[model samples]
Target chain A: MSSVHFDQVYKRYENGHEAMRHVTFQVNRGEFVFITGHSGAGKSTLLKLIMLMERPTRGQIFVDGKNLKSIGSRAMPYFRRSIGVVFQDHQLIPDRTVFDNIALPLIISGYPDKDIGRRVRAALDKVGLLKKENYYPIALSGGEQQRVGIARAVINKPTLLLADEPTGNLDPELSNEIMELFMRFNRAGVTVLIASHDRSLVQALNYRTLQLEHGSLIEEEVVA
Target chain B: MKMASPLDEKAAPSPLPTERHKSFGRGVRNMDVVWRDKINAYLRAHRYELVRSLRTLLSAPFSSVITILVIAIAIFLPIALVIIVNNIQLLGGNWDGRPKMTVYLQLDASENAILTAKQTVLALPGVESVNYIPADQALEEFKRHSGFVDILYELDENPLPAVLVVVPDKIGLSNDGSKVLLRQIETLAIVDSVQYDLGWVHRLNSFMALANRFIVVVTLLFSVGAILVVGNTVRLGIENRRREIIVGKLVGATHSFVRRPFLYLGVWYGLGGGLVAWLMAELGLFALSGPMVELAALYQANFQLQGFGLINSALMLVCSGLLGWLGAWLTVAHHLDEIEPL
Candidate 1:
């Protein structure tokens, strides 16, 4: 069964400008999918719809087969808990230590105190950041900060991970490293959907790709 | 899939559920998570923000002290005024047990006739004590006490009229019985006029009323000013941490999650300011009490100065808390939405 399904989805801003039109797609369980297009092609809007950050103007979205339209605001947080989101800007809280940042999801979920410490360490270790746990995000390199962001995303071991250009700010080598990290998470059975515009990176990965142009999904391909 | 090991089995390990079930369970779990860690971390991360806001306020010692002093001064003015009015009202000197009316006889009345009039006045209701001063005795006493003996010897006839001093038995002499008794005394044939300071009593009552209204208006104005001060402080805090709030929201922090610490900060400010205000008011009253007592002694009266009582202190504390909360609420509600992760 699909983990996320967008069926004839549409999103319009309050100014009455339609950002997305009849966008239909499905991402199956454990799938690694990429959404790529030019700026303003509704890539971020698509991620936002999936995150339920913005409600669609029309049509329906199903996350893990539960209709997004029916989810109340009180229940939205719970929906968000199962999904890990990484932004292009790597929005790490600069004031917090890397460890605290990674432990946030666990803390929000109210894992036992001991379990939080254990899982946070494990998540940081997985991102090769176990040694830098005490460092604040401000003191970290861009790649390290991005890794910390990734660590924070996966600490709760979410079933679906959404990366909105997870490596947008990194060099090619670091981007590949970040992609590899996503792959590792996918291998551990987490479904992954990444939104990126890097053509070379898209060609390098043999996965399902959805192309968008002016709010419409123009094409799809399996590079492999 | 590999079969579970003994340890794994003991841990209750199972295959990954279908995506639908996992997401549903996760949604429920996320609700629990957001409140648990994110809210708390937001508070911990923003501790410095609150302290810095307070420190910023305190950095200008002159302004800080002046601000607090201004509030205290405003609060003290009406309170002190009320205290003075209260003492002035007491100056009529324990009228409860000493309700007395003086009746003067006509100039042509004889001393025997005046004494008979006094006995009749004393028989009236609420007439507890009575003393009759014959015209001759009145004149002699005036000469002795008024320090006008040389002037008195130059007078050909005794000028003083016969006087009847009547004290009432009622605790409050303003009762209807006293009024009736006064009217009755006025009707006596030998009595020329009955003298009492009813106008002073009415003036004291009106002054007390005016003092109460003044306290209400002054308290309201000062409270509004306090809220404005606290609101401005919270506004600066929100501006200083604008970027941090954006980052938090982008990383999935909810609105309440971002707003909680500022609320607590406001509470702390109110609590602290309330304590300081109470202390300042009390100290003011303490310093003024000695002078108030000395002034009362000059009039040969015993009047005690009343400080901000426990009830007033409690009220100030509650007012401080409300002001702080209101200030923070206004600031956060106005600015938090403008700060978006986008």
Candidate 2:
């Protein structure tokens, strides 16, 4: 079964500009897909649609084969629990420590105290920030902050991970390191989709890449 | 195939998938968290956030206390006024039983004519009893009772008018029946005039009515003022934590989850203020009781000050709780939206 599918989806802004036009794509279970396009190529718009953050102007989106259009506002939280989202800006709560930021998804998913602690520690350890558990986001470096964001997104062990410009602010070395982390997670049966404009980074990963231009899919290529 | 352990068969701890259903069974689910583990996890994870919010509130204890005191005073003032007015009404002395009317007879009327007039008035509606006094007998009784015996002897002739003391039935004294009887007695030929000072009774009734209306108006004004006071306090609290709130929302905290602590804080403020106000009112009454009793004794009255009753106390507490809740709701509804996760 496909983990995330967008069928003829379109997202038009209020100001008469179409951000995504007739976008159709599917990511298979446990597969890693890269979305590469220019700034206005509707990369973030696509990720937002999958997360149900923005509604499509037309057509349907199926996350784990369930149409998002039919889900009510009350049921949105349940849907959000099945998918994890990581933003380029690394939106970690400044007041909370690294451990707390990672434990957010588990907390929202209602994991038990013991399980949350065990899973949060494990997630932090996976991100190589176990020693900085007590450090707040403000104290962390940019790459470290992004890792914290990634840890929080995956803490609940969601079936799908959606990363929007996960390495946009990192150096090339850190970017490759982050990509390697995503590859490791993908190998462990978590489907991953990343939106980015870094051509070299996309080429280095050699994953299935879908290219968009001016809100429409222009090409699909497999670098390998 | 791997062997399934007995533990695995029974591992499904909950039959219901949703926490909302569990809430119905246990009656103790945190609205923010679904299961006990979730609550514990959230708390353990967000201990810093919780401590920071609490510490920020505690840092300005004096200002918060003053605000709470103002609210308490506002709430207590009207309630105290209500009790005072109620007690005053009770003390004005309900004269339902004693209805006396002094009837003056014509000076030239003969004793037999005066006696007949008294008998006629006594037979009228609501007339319970009557006593007749001849002009000569009246003068003699005035001389003995008024301490004017020497002056009475100096008079050339008896100057006292014959009078009839009329006492009406208890029901007649308080209702329209007594007024009707007064009209009938005035029409008697030998009677000069019939008088009952209804002015005092009328004044008391009007005063009580005015007091009730005043209490209602004052209470309404104070209730609105209480809401504004609490709203302003919550607004300040939100302002202080604006950054924290934005971060919480960005990190996937729902609006209600972010709002719960503020709501609790508001309730706490209200309860504390209400308790303080009740204490202040009770102390004020206790202090005034001594002087009020002494004054009542001077008037040979059995008046006693009534203290705050249970119903009034409960009402005060409820008002406090509502004010707190209302204030928090107003602040949350208005300000929480302004904070965006973006």
Candidate 3:
């Protein structure tokens, strides 16, 4: 079954600016896809739509066969657990340690202490930040901070991963490093969807790519 | 760069698995096990959040102290007034548990008139018994005590009138009953005047009623003040941790989870304030104890300032805590929604 299905989704803000227009797409389970668009191309808004943070003005969204519109505010948190999200600004809580930041999702889902420790450590290792668990995000470099963000996004072992500009601050080398990490999780049966405009990396990686322009999907290409 | 395999392939345990999620429960996971784990998880989160919230307050000692001190003072004032009112009630009670009425007859009343008056008084309702002191006998007793026996012999006749000390029945000792009986006895033709100290009882009764109303109003005002004090404090706390709350909500924290720590912070505030209020009550009682003892000595009575009982202290803590919780809940419910991550 498809993990994400958007059917004729249209999103318009109250200010009359259209963020998405009649967009339709489907992501198969365990697929790695990148949403590439220039700034204001509605890439972030698309991720928000899938996350149900912003509702589409018209259209339906289904995540893992469950209709998002039917989910109430109380159920929104639980629904979000099936998906992981990383942000462009690396929204890691500055006051907390790297370990605590990653442990947040697990803690929200009420994971046992032992399970939290193992999973947090494994996720840190997955992002190659295992030794920096005790350090604060401020002490880490831009690449390292985004890695912490990634570690947190997947700590709960979500089936679907959604990242918006996950490497917007990183250099080409670190961007590739982050993209490769998403590939690893995808290979492990976790569907990954990253919204980034780094064309060199998007063209270089072997995944389905959806390119958006002027609030509409203009290109659908599969990289070899 | 080439894609690598996942770091660890071992699946992490699923905390809540659906009944038909057979693959997750393959070996050791079962319905009963899952239920137990969920319950355990809930308890652990509750415990951790409770302690963590308390630590948050303790970490900021000066501000916490001021907040708690304000709450304590609010609680203490009403309770102190309550204590003062209670002591006054006790003092008023000792004035006269059962006062008597005195009837003075005309000095020139004949023996037959005295006899008729005695018989008439005995027949009245609520008149338990009456003692008749004739004029000459009253003058003799007064002369012995007044050291005026020689002076009394110089007078033409005894100036003292026949006095009838009337004791009322138990029913007559109550508020309105005493007044009714006094009126009935005063209308007698032979009686010159009727006197009873029930006036003091009536005044004391009204004073007590007024005091009770004052206490209720005062307690209500102070309780609301305490709640607002706690509410404002929690509001500041929510503002300070606004970022943390946003992150928590973004990462899938339920509203309750975001609210738990603030609720606990309010509880700690209540706890400290309640205990401090109790402390202030004891201290206030202690400070006044010396004067109380001296006053009681002058009255030849043994009166001690009543300290708070154990149950009262416990109730104070619980009530203050509840107010604190309510205050936190109000603020959190009001502010947490505005904190959703964009």
Candidate 4:
């Protein structure tokens, strides 16, 4: 079954701006997919729609086989608990330490304290930052901050992971490292969908790519 | 195509650890164990949120203290007013200011004639009781109270006259009947003069009633002001944590979860304000007790200052906390919706 399926979805803002137009796509469970587009090519809008942050103006979208239209605002949190999201700026709360940042999702999910500590440590180990649990986000380097963001997203062990320009601020080397980290999670039976404007990076990884232009899905490419 | 919502499907995989644990042995699971875990997790979440919110307030101690003081002062005004009005009413109640007429008699009147006059006054309509004061006893009491012993001794004759203190019935005090009684006493052959001042008692009763109404209005106005004070402070708190709220929402935090800390802040502010206001009012009352006793002594009235009783104090603290909770709930409900992850 498809983890995320968008069928002829359209998103138009209040001021006559259409962010997504007839965007139809599907990402099966355990698949790694990349959304490629220019800055205003509806990349972020697609991710927002999937996260239920914004509703489509037309057509139905499905996540984990449940139609998006059926989910109300009250049910948004419950739905989102099944999915993970990472942002370009790494959205780590400045006041919280790295461990606290990752443990937030678990805390929100009502995990036992002992379980939270053990899972947070495991996530930290998975991100190769186990020793920096006490460090605040401000003390981390750009790449390390992004890694912490990834750790937080995956800590809940969501079936689907969404990232919007996750490597947008990093150098090429750091960006590739972040991509490899996504590949590892994708291999672990978690479906990964990342949106990035980097053409060379998409070409190097050669995953299933969905290209968006003028708020429309123009092409789908699978290299290798 | 029709599709089933994963939420209702038993076949769907549960992402939350708690759900997954419950699904492990869905039919065979021990209900008691599940309930215990649920309660423990619930308690842990509350304990964690409580500490988290308290730290947020303590992180800015100066601002928190200032906000609390503003709330305290706002609530203190009405509380102090209520206490003052209460004391005034207590004094009035104790005085029981029924109408009374003091009749001074001629010094040369015979003792038998004075007794006959007292019996006549007691028999008059609406006259409750009449007590006679002999000339020698009156002179001795005057010397003791007037602080003029030498002057009294220098006079060759005792100039003070015998007196009769007459108390009127409640019905007579309520209307003009008492004045007619006074006039009747004035015409007595043995009486020199009759004095009665019922107007002052009437004025004081009316004034006390007005004070009670005034306190009710003032207390209501100040309670609203206190709630708003807490509301605005919580609103500002929500603004400062706007980014955190947005991030929390993005990560699947429920509205109540995001609202928990701000609500706690409001309760803390209200409770702190209540405690400080209570202290301020009690201390002020304490300081005034000495002066109040002296003032009561001047009037020759025995009275003691009454405080906001134990129940009243407890009621105030609970009310302040609830107001804080209500303010925070309102602010959080309004502001949390405005902040969306998008």
- Best by the lDDT measure: 4
Candidate 1: tens digits of C-alpha lDDT, residues A78-167: 566668888777777676789877876554443455777898899888989889889989899989988888988887678899999888
| Native interface contact recovery, model 1 | 0.06
Question: Candidate 3, residue B216: CA error in Å?
Answer: 1.8
TM-score of chain B of each: 0.60, 0.64, 0.74, 0.72
Please report, in order, the local distance difference test score of every candidate based on alpha carbons: 0.73, 0.77, 0.83, 0.85
lDDT of 4 at B209: 77
Stretches of candidate 1 off by over 4 Å are A14-17, A103-118, B1-184, B190-193
DockQ scores of all models, one per candidate:
0.25, 0.21, 0.42, 0.42
Summed over model 2, clashes come to: 0
Q: 2 or 4: which has the higher lDDT?
A: 4
Candidate 4 lDDT, B1-342, residue by residue in tens: 122232222212234533645555756556555555556665666678789888988999999999899889877988898898888778666645665677899879999999999999999988889989899989998886554777899999889899998888875575778768878888999989877757777788788778878878887887788788889999998888887888888888866678778878889989999999999999998999999989877755567899999999999999888888878878888788898866
- Measured over all alpha carbons after superposition, the RMSD of each candidate to the real structure, in angstroms, is 9.0, 8.8, 7.7, 5.8
Off by over 4 Å in 2: A106-115, B1-56, B93-177, B185-199, B239-255, B297-304, B337-342
User: Can you give the lDDT of residue B285 in candidate 2?
Assistant: 89
lDDT (10s digit) by residue, model 2, range B168-264: 8764576688778888898888889877755566677788889899999998888778778878888888887776675555444545556756766
- By DockQ, the better pick of 2 and 3 is 3
Between 1 and 4, whose TM-score is larger? 4
Better of 1 and 3 by lDDT: 3
